[model samples]
Target: MSTQKRTVLITGCSDGGLGAALARAFKDAGFFVYATARNPAKMQSLAALDIETLQLDVQSQESVNSCAARIKQLDVLVNNAGGQFVMPLSDVDIEAAKKIYDLNVWSQIRVIQAFLPLLIASKGMIVNNTSIASVAAVPFQSIYNSSKAAIASVSETLRLEVEPFGVKVIDLRTGVVKSNLINNLKETQHPKLPDGSIYEFAKDTVEKALRQDGFEGQGLDQAVWAKAIVGDLMKKNPPALIWRGESAWLSRIASILPHGLLDGTLKKLVGLDIVEKAIKEGRH
Candidate 1:
């Protein structure tokens, strides 16, 4: 029997993001933190803290398999590597949407399967970081919503399957957080997002919405959120779903509403209603 403290490996833990915050929180809770990112250079600050840093790109099976192979044991696996792009479902490039799903959905499946042996050995927990939008699907974020919803579903199935093996599975219904999400938005240049004729009404508003969700983020605090998640990870019997954050309440509310009502509510909230009205009035 090994007497070493539990080890936690979190993906996409570059600096200035929630994954990094989670690594710090887990370390504070006395766990060995292996914080990984596609580009290890981005995690130099975390490495400076003596946290193990690896270049693990969930998008690449070779990267995931190699990282998993290096670890003899893992107590917690946090699937936090995900990305998104905002655009109308109509205008979104299918290829771009597929890429988001590959990162958010398939990537998680790949990592979890690769780490299953270690998890089964330790009877450890797996936390798949999903979004509130999973069940609270809103417009213009269809691709993101769909990908996260798939996570929620697959996590539930994973929980059932792994329970007999004594492995706990958690779908962390993450709310909007303060992190590089805003930076990601700023770093990317999307011509259609701001000035496309079809997107004129909502693009700027959507940009504001994403920035607000990441900054003001409705009072989202990364440190606080990470603390909550780490606490759950340490529990002897954690919930199947650890749901919290700025949008958690709204997500719950959205779930109770009818599809039509929910869609209408989201349109108004994100300025999609204005765009719809313009289209109805035949205005360019």
Candidate 2:
């Protein structure tokens, strides 16, 4: 065992988020962790834990460049800075949806491009944080699902593109782990009022589906989830795809089901079956 530690740079590591959890887990595993956030102050506790912290807004090229410039030996790069868009596509504000893609999709490209030199030198790996939504688009979160689906595509193309350079890119299709995202997205502004759209009469049902993360015993702990991620990445022959989280198996099942069956199941689970019945009965 060498005392010299491999360095890892992770974005969106604000406290209480999975990024911060990864920072701590990697730090505990003897990796030098660079925990970054759009606002460094949000990661003050990470600094207190002796992990290096950087201020990085992945949406801004300058910010990405500055952060990349400061890293001299990045052995692993994690793209985790992203937001959620929870609404029907018809009512999804195009501008806001673009912002979601900017953060969720393009930010990964920006950071990867900026740090490619370091990764190439280290023969390192890129871990992209995508969601199971990529496999099966959720009912109202179409924008979010599509954005992750884009990353899913990018991950495959990138893995092939970077393999000859001795760099590996892994798409981590994470299932819901407990995080502040649910709380944060509650504040997300959408153009459609819940009470005045296709879901107007099914507002409660729709909202419940949005909030119900398929977790076991409360939900997966962010720390445990992060540990699993870092653990898998550290494997000698890490796969191109690493999938795990609460009810993650369910997502895998959902992904392979027949299209009609999957669609019908999702609609019924979200109370759409009831909504459809109500609509037919003059309820809406």
lDDT of 1 by residue, 1-284 (tens): 13398999999999988899999999999988889999999998799899989989898889998998889889899999898667667677788789889999999999999999999999999999997878876777788899999999999999999999989999999877777775685567242453454666556666565443435444478999999888877777888878778878778777787666677777777777777887799875
The local lDDT score (0 to 100) that residue 206 gets in candidate 2 is 63
The C-alpha RMSD of each candidate to the native structure, in angstroms, is 2.6, 2.8
Name the runs in model 2 displaced over 4 angstroms: 1-3, 190-196, 207-218
Alpha-carbon shift of residue 79 in model 1 (angstroms): 0.1
**What is the Å distance of residue 116 in model 2 from its true position?**
0.8
Clash-forming residue pairs, model 2: none
TM-score of 2: 0.92
lDDT by residue (1-284, candidate 2, tens digit) is: 12258989999999888899999999988898889999999998799998889899999999999888777787899998898877766566688889999999999899999999989998999999988889875677789989999999999999999999999999998887888776666556523444457777777766666664442235588889988888999999999988888767788887777766677776775566787888899987
Give the alpha-carbon lDDT of every model.
0.83, 0.84
Off by over 4 Å in 1: 1-3, 189-218, 280-282
Minimal lDDT window, size 10, model 1: 210-219
